[model samples]
Target chain A: MTATAFQFDDVTFAYRTQRALEGVSLTIRSGERVALLGANGSGKSTLLRMMDALCFPASGTATAFAAPLTEAAFQDDATNYAFRRRVGLVFQNPDVQLFNPTVSDELAFGPLQLGWEKPKVRDAVDTVSARFGIAHLKDRPPHRLSGGEKKRVALASVLITEPDVLLLDEPTAALDPASRANLVGFLAREPGAGRTVVTATHDLDIVEDIADRAIVLAEGRVVADGPVLAVLHDVDLLRRTHLVFEHRHSHGGPPAGSHGHMHSSRQEG
Target chain B: MADQRYGICGCGRGRRGALDSLVLGLVNAEAYALDAEATATRPGFLQSVDPRIKVLALVALIVATTATRSLVVLAALFVAAVALALISRIGPGRLARQVWVGVLIFSGIIVLPAIFLVPGTPIVHLPVVGWAITLQGLRSAAFVVGRAETAATLALLIVLTTPWPHVLKALASLGVPAAAVAVLGMTYRYVFVLIEAARHMMEARRSRIVAPLDGRERRRMLMTAIGMLLAKTFALGSDVHAAMIARGYRGEVRLLHDFHTRPPDWVFLAIALAVPALILGLQP
Candidate 1:
C-alpha cells in the first residue's frame, strides 16, 4: 500500500482578515509527483506552507505522514526535527530562501540544523554544490548571484538534506525562458524521482513534464483534481480557474483550419 | 506632457534629488560589494591567513596603535599597515580613496583649531589671525590623525581580505554570542535585497514624473516611498522567518563550523602579535 504523504481534511486558513484557504482537502501519496495549479492568491502557497508545518489550519485537520500538523505537534523538538528532515520547502522568492551569507553555508544550513555531524555536513555541501553546478559559487554571497543561480542554490540547499517530500512554491515564477526550461528539465529528471514532489505553480506548459497529477485551486477551493492530461484537457475548469484562456490564432499557411487554442494566462510572447 | 524645464523644479542647480541619491547609493553599494569580493578572493598574504587569527591579530595591532604614545611607533605601525596592504594586492590608490585621503581631510580640519589652542612652543603665526601654531599642537594632531588612519587601515584590511561569512564565523568562534552573529549575518545578506527593492521603487517613481515636483511634493513623495519600503521590508522579514522555520531553524541558530587553522596561520598570528609587542616595548 502506498503511504499517504499529506492529508488535508477541510483545511481552512486565514491571514488576519483575509481568507487564504477554505475547505481545501487533498491526499498525496508517497513518491507521487503532484502539481498545485492556481492563479495568484488562490491558496496554493498557503496550502503548501501548511503541509510543511510552517503554519497550521485554522479550523480543520492537516496531516503529514499521518502525523497531525499543528503548532503543538511541532512544539516537540524530536517530532519537529524529524518532520523537517523528512520534508523540505523551497520558497517562492529565492531571496527569502537564500538568507545565509554564502551559497556553501546556505546549502549546509539544513544539515547543521538537523544535527548532522560536521564531516557529514561538509560532504553534503560539497556533493550538492557540485551536483547543482554551484561549486564555483560556494564562497559567493547569495546577493551576488543572478536570478537563475539563486534559484538553483535555493533548490540545492533544500535538496542537500535528501528529503522524502519536496514542496516548491511557484518554482518557475520569475525564471527566464532558458532558465525555466533548465529548471523544468531538472525537475523532470532524477532528483524528483521517488520523492513526493508538490510544486505550486500557474505555468501550464511545464506541468506535463514535472507532475503526473494536477490539483487545481480556484478562489481558495479545489476546483479540479485528476491526472495531468485530464486536468489540462479540462478547458472550462482551466479558464474558470484563470489558469488559461481560449485565444483565437491562425496559422500563416491557411485560415481554413484555424481554431481557438488555449493560451496560459501567464504566457508571455 | 509637462515641460522638461518645469520638471526639473526641485532638482535644480546644486541640488540633488532624492531619486538621484537613491540610485547613487545603490551604485556605490554595488561597487563596494564587488570590490570587497574581488579583493577577498585574490591570492594574497592576508587573504591566505585564517580569518580568526587575522581578526585577532589585526585587532591587537589596532589596540596597540591606540595605546602607544610614541610618534615613532605610530608612524612605524602606519607604514607597516601600508606595507601589508601592498603585499595583499591592495593598491596605493585604493588605500588612498578607502582610507587615507578622507581621514586626512576630516582629521586635518578637526585638528586645525588645536594648532592655535594648545599651549606649547610657538612655531608659526597665522598671517590674518596672528594665532601661534604651537609644536605641541602639531604633535597632538599627528598622533590623532596617525592613530585614526592606522586603525582604519587595519580594519579595512580585515574586511578586504576575509569573506564576510568567515569573519562572522570567526567572531562566533571567538566567543561572540551566536544570536548576535546570526543577526549580523542576516542583516548583511538582506541589505542587498532591500537596496534592490529601493532601487526599483526609485526607478518607478522617476519613470512616472510627468509634472514638476516642488519641495513639498518631493518631501511627501519621499515620505510615501519610505513608508512603502518599510511595509515591504516587514513583509519580507515575515516571509524570511517562515523560510527559516521551514528549514528547521528552530530558534537557536546553528552554522557550519568549517574553519581550520594551518601552520602558516599560526606563524602569521605569532608575527602579528610579536610586532605589536615589539612596538609597545620600544615605546618610551
Candidate 2:
C-alpha cells in the first residue's frame, strides 16, 4: 500500500452525554475522491469532523499524517498548524466560512492564518477568485452577495490554503444552478497528484463530477466502499440509504453505449 | 404559552423578547425584516446624502451637545435635532415609537428619576426621594439626559439615513481610525452569517425530531450553535485579516480606491464645520 492517508480503528466519540460517533474503521488513500453519503443525523458530519480533527473519537485510535489523533492530538501548536496545513475544511453554511468584508479577503483567510508572505497570499487570492470567475467581486462585502456568490467565496477561501486533504460538509447545499455547476466543475478539476477529497453530503449528483471513490456511512459505521460509479449505481445499495441519484455518461467510443444510463442529476451550470 | 424572542420586529413581539433592537439592526442584515408584501423603503434625503458629510456633521453635533448644560440652550438644541430628524422621512408613527422605546429606556436607567430627586430651578421634586434633589444635581441630570437624547437621535438618524458601508468609507476619510471601523465592519459582515447558521440549526432541528427536544438535544443545539458561531466569527475574522494582508492591508486602514471626496463634499464639510464652530464660539 502506498502509505494510507488515514487509518481509523473502531473509533467512538461523544459530546458530553450524547454519543455522536461509534465504532468505525476506514482507510482513505491519497488521490481518492470519496463521497460520504447519509441523511442528516446519520453521523456523516461527525465522522467528517473527526477526520478534520474538529472533534476527536472517544474510543479507538484514528491517524492522519503519521500522527495519531487520539489522546493528545492537539498538544503542540506547530504540529496542529502543520496538520491543518495538510487538511482543509469547508463548512455547509457559506456565511460561516466567509468573514471578510470583501471577496479577496475571504480568499486570503487561510493562507494568512498559515502566515504566508504578503505576495503569496495575494497570488493565492487572485488565482482562486479568478478560477471561480469572481474577480469582479473583490471589494464587495460578503453579506450583499447572492447565495451562489457567497458559496464561491467560501470555496475560494479554502482553496487558498492549498491543503493535501479536503474535508467538505455539504459543499453544494444552497448554491444556485450555475453556482452549483461551477462548484462541481471546479471540484472535478483534477486535484494535485497526491491530494485527497472527503465530503459529507446526500447530494449524489456531485458523485460523477468529483468522487473517484465512495464511502457510505450509516449511524456512524461504514456500510460499503468501492469505485464511485460502481458504488453509486448499485440499486440495492442506494435503496438502503438516502443516496439515490445516478450519474449517466454519454458514449464516445466502441462499447461505451453498453454502460450508458438514463440521466445524471447534475444541477445544470 | 412560553414567549419567544421576536428580534426587534414588533409583529414577532408575541414570539420573543419585546425589545427595540431596531437601531443596531437598521443598517444590518440579520434583523432584516423581509416583507414580501412590503415595498422597499425609499431612501430619504438624509439617507441619500454623502456618507462622509453625515459622519462629520453627526460627530460635530455629538461633541457640541456633550459639551453643553444650559437647559434653555439644550432644550432648543433638542427641538432642532428633532425637526432635523423628521426631515429624514421616517414616519411620525415609527419615530415616536422608536423614541419612546429607545430614549426612554436608555434615559430612565440613568437620569429619568434624577430630575425629581435633584432640584434645578426647583421646577419639580419627587414626592418620594425628595431629599436627594439639588439644583446642581438636577442640572447635571438634565445636561446628560437632554444632550444624550439629542446626540443619540442625531447619531441614529445618520445611521438610519446612510448605508453602513458608506459610513465606513466616510469615517476612513475623516481619520476616525481603522480599528473602530473594523468593529462595525465585522458586525455587518457576520451578523447575517450567524443568523444563517441559526436558521440551519433550526432547520436541522425541525427535520429530525418531531417535538421540541429531549433537553439534551436542546442543550446540544444551543451549545453547537454557540460553538459554531464562535468558530465562524473567529474564522471569518482571520480570513478578513488575511484578505487585508493579501490586499496589502497594513496596520493603517485606507479608503477604497473608488472612494473620493468631491468639491461639493468639501463645501458640505465646510458648512457643517462652520455651523458647529459658529454655535460653539457663540455659546458662553
Candidate 3:
C-alpha cells in the first residue's frame, strides 16, 4: 500500500452553531490526485483547509505525513513554516489571495519569506512567472490585471513555493473557457513528481483529466469514494450527493446519415 | 421619485444629484489609479532613477525646504520642483490639478486668516473686512504656503515617478518598521479593491431602485450596505490573513526588491541634495 500522505480520522469541526464537517475519516496516499466533489457548503473547502492546517478539528485527529495536525503543533514557528512550505493552498478568490502590488512580488513573497537569498528568490520568481506566461505582467499590479491574469498570478504565487501538497479550492471558478482549459491542461500534464494535488471543484468535466480518484461529500459526510470515472459516471450517486443536478436533456443524435448516433438520458427535474 | 430632503438640500433633485455624484466618485477613484500608472510608465528622467535614491533625495529636499525660513529659498525650491515635474513628463496641468488644487488652495485658505491675525507692520488694508495686512504676517503666510507647496510637489513627484511597489520597498530598506511597511503595502493593494467593491455595490443598489428613496430611506439603505460591507471586509481580512499564513508568511513581510543604481542615479541624487543645501546656504 502507498504511504498515507494525509489521514483524517473522525475529524469534526463547527463554525459557531453550524457543523461544517462531521466524522470525516479519510486517508489520502502519497502522490494521489483526489477530486473533492460536493455542492456549496458541503464542507469541501473546510476539508481542504483542515488538510493545510489552517483550521483545527474539534474532535478526532488530522495527521499529515504521520504528524498530528493541531494548533499546538503549529505553535512552533519552525514547524508551522515547514508545514506551510510543504502544503500550499490556492484560495478561491484571487482578490483576497493576491495582496502584493506587482506580479513579481506576489510570486517572490513565499520564497522570500522562507529566507531564500535575493538572487535565488529572483530566479525563482522569474522562472515561475515565465512558466505561468505572466512575464509581461511582472511589473503590473495584480489587482489591475484581468480576471484570468489575476488567477494565473494567484496560482503562480502559491506554486512558486514548490509545495509538496497542492490543495486548491474551486480552482476553476470564474475563469473563462480558454483559461479554464489552460489550467486543466496544465494540471493534467504537470502533476509534478512527489506532489499530491487535491482540488475541490464542482467542474466535473475536467475531473477525469485532472484527478484519478474522487471523494464526494454531502452535508459534511463522505457519500462516496471511488475512481473518478466510476463516481462521475454514476449519475444516480452524483445527483443524490447534489454534486450534479438531475437534468433531463439529450443532444438527440449525431449528424444526419452518420455511422453512429449519440444520446444521453437521466432523471427528471 | 420621491422628494428626498438631503442634508445639503431639501428636495428630490438632491437625491438625483446624489446618485450622479456617486457615479462621479467612481470615476475620480479610477482616474487616480490611471494617473499613477501613467506617471510610472511615462518616459522621463525621474521615472528611470532608482526609487531608493529618489525617495531619499525628495525627502532631503522636503527637510531642506521646511528648515529654511527664507521666502527666496522656498520660492527657488518650488520652482525647482515644478521644473522637475515638467522634465519628468508629468504635465503641468496634472500637477496643478493634484498639488495646486489639493494642497496649495487648502493651505492658502488656512494661511489667509493668518495674514489678518498676526501682529506685524501694516502692508495693505482689506477693503471689505477693513483689516490691515501686515508685512510680517504676509511674509509668514507666504512662507507657510510656499513650504507646503514645495514639499507637496516633491512628494507627489516621487509617487508619480516611481511604481508603488518600489516606493514601499525603498521605504522598507531605508529603516522603516517592518510591520508599518507591511501595512503600507497591504493598504496600497487592498484599498483599491475595497473601493471598486463599494462602487459595484452602489451601482447594484442603484440598478435595483424601482423608485427614488427619501433622505431617511436612502440613509438607511446606505447604512445597511455599509454594515454589510464592513462585515464582509472583516471576513475577507481574516481569509486574506489566513491565505498569507498558509503561504509561509509569518508576520515579517520579506520581498525581493531588486534595484541597481547606475552612475547617473548618484549624479541625480547629488544634484537634488545640493540644490536644497545651496538654497539654504544662500539664505540671509
Candidate 4:
C-alpha cells in the first residue's frame, strides 16, 4: 500500500474578509501524479501553500506524511527541518523563488538552509545546475535570465534538496511556445522515480501529459476529482469552471455551418 | 493662444516632459546595472581577484587618495587609476561618460567661487566684475577636483569589476552584520523589479495621453502612480517572504561562500596595497 503524502480534511482558509478555500478535503498518495486545475483566484495556490506548511488551515486539519501541518508542529526545529527536506514548493513566479544573488547560490539555498555540509552543498549546486542545463548561467543573476532560464533555475533550486514530493504552481505560465513545449516534455518525463508531483495549473492542454489524476476547483470549492481523462472529457464541468470556453466557428466545407464546440481554449501550436 | 501664454496648454512642442524623463531615468538605471554585470563577468585583471582582497585594497587606495594634500601625489593617484582601468579592460570612454565628466562639472561649479573669493596673489581679473582670480584659490580648486576625481575612479573601478553580491559578501567578511548584508542584497535584487514595474505604469499612462498634461494634472497622475507602485511592492514583498519560508529560510540567510584565493590573488593584493602606500609615502 502506498503512503499518503497529503491529507486535507474539511480544510477551510480565509484572507481577512475574503475566503480563499472552503471545505477542501482530499488525499494524495505517494508517487501519484496529480494536477490541481482551476481558473485565476480559484484557491489552487492557497491549497499548495497549505500542503507545503507555509500556511495553516483556518478550520479542520491538514496533514503531510501523517504529520499535522500546524504552526505549533513547525515550532520544533527537528520536525520543521525534516519536513522541509522531504518536500519542496516552486512558486508561480520565478522572481519570488529565485531570490539569491546568483543561480548557483539559489540552487544551494535549500540544502544550506537544511544544514548540509559545505562541500555537499557545492556538489549539489553543480549537479543540479548541470542537470537543468543551466551550467552556463550558474553565476548570472536571476533578473538577467530570460523567462525560460529563470523557470529552469527555479526548478533546479528546489530539486537540489532532492525532495520526495514536489509541488509546482502554474509551472508553464508566461512561457513561449517552444519553452512551454520543453517544460511540458520535461515534466512528462517525471524527473525523479516515484516522486509525488502535484502541479497547480489552469493549462488544460498539457494536463494529460503531466498527470494521471485531476482535481478541479471553482469558487474555492472542489467540484470534481477523478482520473485525468475522465475529468478532461467532462465538458460541462470544464465550462462551468471556466477552464474551457464554447468555441463557435464555421468551416468552408460540407456541414460547415457555424456550430458551438467545447474544447481546450488554448490553440494548438 | 491665451492658454499657451499661460503655460497650461501647448502643442507642436517636441521637448521631453517630466514623465518621459522619469521613464528614461528608470530605463537607464536598469541598463547601467546590466552593463556593470557584463563588465564584471569579463576576463580582466580586477575581475579575477578575490572580492575580499579587492575590497580591502581599493578601500585603502581611496583612503590614501583622500589623506594626501599634495597636488602632485593626487595627480599620480589619478593617473594610476586610469592605468588600472586600462588593465581591467574598462574603456577610457566609459570612464569619461560614467564618472569623469559628471564629477568635473559638479565639482567645478562647487569650487568656482573659491577661485576668486580666497585672499592670495591675483592671477587674473574679470574686467566687468573686477574679481581677482588668486593663485592660492586655483591651487585649492585643483586640489579639491583632483581628490574627488581620483577617489571616485577607484570606487567606480570596484563597482565595475566586482559583482554587487560579492561586494556585499566581502563586507560581511569585514565585520558587517549578516542581517545587514542580506537586506542590502535583497534591496539590490528587487530594485530592478520595481523599476520595471514603474516603467510599465508610465508606459500605460503615456499610451492614454491625447494632449499635454498641465503641471497640476501631471503632479496628480504621478502621485497616483507612485501609490499604486507602493501597493504592488508591498504585495510582492509578502509573496517573496512566503516563498522564502517554503524553501526553509529560517530567519537567517545562508549563501554559498565559494571565494578561494590563489597565489596570483595574493600578488595582486600586494601590488594594490604597495601602490597606494607608495603614493602616501611620496606625499611631501
Top of the candidates by TM-score:
1
Q: Best to worst by TM-score, what's the order?
A: 1, 3, 4, 2
What is candidate 3's CAPRI-style docking category based on DockQ? medium
- Tens-digit lDDT track of model 1 for B1-284: 11232232353543557855775666677679778978898999999988999999999889889988989889989998999899999988998998899999998899888878999999999899899999999999999999999999999999999988999999989989988998999988888888878777876776787766799988898889889989999999999999888888888888876778999889888887887787678776
Tens-digit per-residue lDDT, B1-284, candidate 4: 32232232245574456655676676778789989988998998889989998888888888878888878778988898898899999989999999999999999999999999889999899999899999999999998899889999999999999999899878888778877888888888988888878777876786678876788888898888889988999998998998888888889877667689989888877877886687667766
Cα TM-score per model: 0.93, 0.62, 0.92, 0.91
**Model 4 per-residue lDDT tens digits across residues A108-212:** 889988999989999998888888899999888898899999999998888899899999999998899898999999889945679999999999999999999
State each candidate's clash count. Answer: 0, 14, 0, 0
Instruction: Give the DockQ of candidate 2.
Output: 0.14
Q: Which residue segments of model 2 deviate by more than 4 Å?
A: A1-3, A15-20, A99-105, A117-123, A138-143, A190-194, A245-269, B1-64, B70-145, B157-284
Q: After superposition, how far is residue A31 of candidate 1 from its true place, in Å?
A: 2.2
Q: Write the per-residue lDDT of candidate 1 for residues A139-176, one digit (tens) a residue.
A: 88989888899999999999999999999898887888
lDDT of 3 by residue, B1-284 (tens): 11221122344443544444554565566668777878788899899889999998999889888988777778888888999898898888988888877787789889998898899899899898799999888898999888888899999999899888889889988889877888988887887777777767766776677766778887787677778778878988999899888888888888666789999999988987887687668767
Scored against the native two-chain complex, candidate 3 gets a DockQ of 0.76
The alpha-carbon lDDT assigned to residue A192 of candidate 1 equals 53
Mind giving the per-residue lDDT tens digits that candidate 2 earns over B205-246? 445644434556556766766677678768766654533432
lDDT of 4: 0.87
lDDT of 2 by residue, A19-114 (tens): 767788889987678888876677888887788776687889999977888537566666666777788777776666665567765676566566
- Residue A173 lDDT (model 1): 79
**What is the lDDT, from 0 to 100, of the residue B168 in candidate 4?**
81
What CAPRI-style quality would you assign to candidate 4?
medium
On a 0 to 100 scale, what is the lDDT of residue B217 in model 1?
85
Worst 10 contiguous positions by lDDT, candidate 4 chain B: B1-10
